[model samples]
Target: MSEARPYGFEVVRLARLEARLVVYDWAWARDNAERVTENWRRRVAGQPALFDGPVLLACDCAIVGEVCRLSLFETTYARFLAYRDGGSPDGHVANAFAAIVPWSADGAVLLGRMGAHTANAGQIYFPCGTPDPGDVRGESVDFSGSAGRELLEETGLDLPEDAPEDWVCLRGEGQLAFLRPVRFSDAAATLIDRMETHAIREDEPELSGIVAVRSAADIDAAMPGFVRAYLASAFDAGARARRRRT
Candidate 1:
């Protein structure tokens, strides 16, 4: 078996989904690291004029099944003036606009390995249930509330009433934000099933599919590199906790 790679995130159980807690790793923040830092600097630089209309946002990436795997939460701010002005005096306005990286938790139920679409056309892997809506941008003063709203808009999956309130930060670039569910309830599962069925029937009616993975080998054979890394981290964490209990 191939060794698992280390990932800078953690997943905690929630009543209806697993909440992925992100450990910010500066080293992992590749390519766009400087851009993100510069963005923060500009925000701080313009704090006086930008504070009044600042908006907060949350976003997540999720994997679904018996052991739910999800990405970390991220928080970002969007300035209203950046939208209206179109540009900043310091040339940082582009980064200033739509600063609130919307929070969302997705349940990517792996339906086994199969050829599917990719940026590199013709290249394929086990495509999971409904690809994340990519990044649905939004602006709101209430990050949590706005996150919930965005989740509904993007996936049509409403979170359980007792879901966790805190946000988990993931390490990445593009000023993107994400959150993952800590647990999955029967109702949530049912909703997902319905959504998947609807999408398959309406979009790709001829395809055969299943929800989540049936075994470790299934996961191994199906998942893409990044997804595999995430699952390995989550499984390792779970195994360590279990060993501690015993």
Candidate 2:
């Protein structure tokens, strides 16, 4: 196996982001839909709670000096899933969106385990979802809104409406994780217990359980590749902070 490349991210704050559907790339979109159908037949053993709703998937991106300018437009949820499984005909499509990495003051990162009936069953990841039409205001993308809505829907932990520590975009393969931190005053155990109880009470819960990660080793094999990379970066940063304190 090849050596795993370290994930690189650009620190960008949530500001004016333009996300309007440009002219639909017909050929590209059709190819993406075909790929999605193929993959769904092979990978998905059963039906998932999916909708044919339209979403914006990145068609192009580039690092212009210090900024990463992305070109995104409308595509269906089916196409987005297909694009996620390396189905983009142009190979430029990316799963680009924001997520909330809830952290306690005591060095614990809270992650959620997907329920068996959900699309990402058994996978471990932070509370987040893909950006949809609900996240758009005029032409700008409201990543903070996307982050907060997803966190509330999944974990039921209502964060202060306007407090995100920092924003970073993790790029690898076909994924782009726009992650933001939501710090809590509660201890790890307390937060985990609360989240788990919330999940249990949910009618159609997305998460089956909550996992509290205090160290890198606590990140298990069930986590997706991008999630593991994020955890590794987070853990290393924590270690360096401890060294500074010492």
- Which candidate number has the best lDDT? 2
Error of 1 at 111 (Å): 8.2
lDDT score for residue 16 of model 2: 34
TM-scores, all candidates, are 0.38, 0.84
How many backbone collisions does model 2 have?
0
lDDT of 1 at 50: 32
Report the CA-based lDDT of candidate 2 relative to the real structure: 0.72
Q: How do the residues 71-130 of candidate 1 rate in per-residue lDDT, one tens digit apiece? A: 332333333233223222332111111111111133333322231322112221222221
* Candidate 1 local Cα displacement, residue 51, angstroms: 32
What's each prediction's clash count? 22, 0
The lDDT values for all models are: 0.35, 0.72
Candidate 2 wrong stretches, greater than 4 Å: 1-21, 24-26, 38-45, 62-68, 87-89
* Model 2 residue pairs with clashes: none
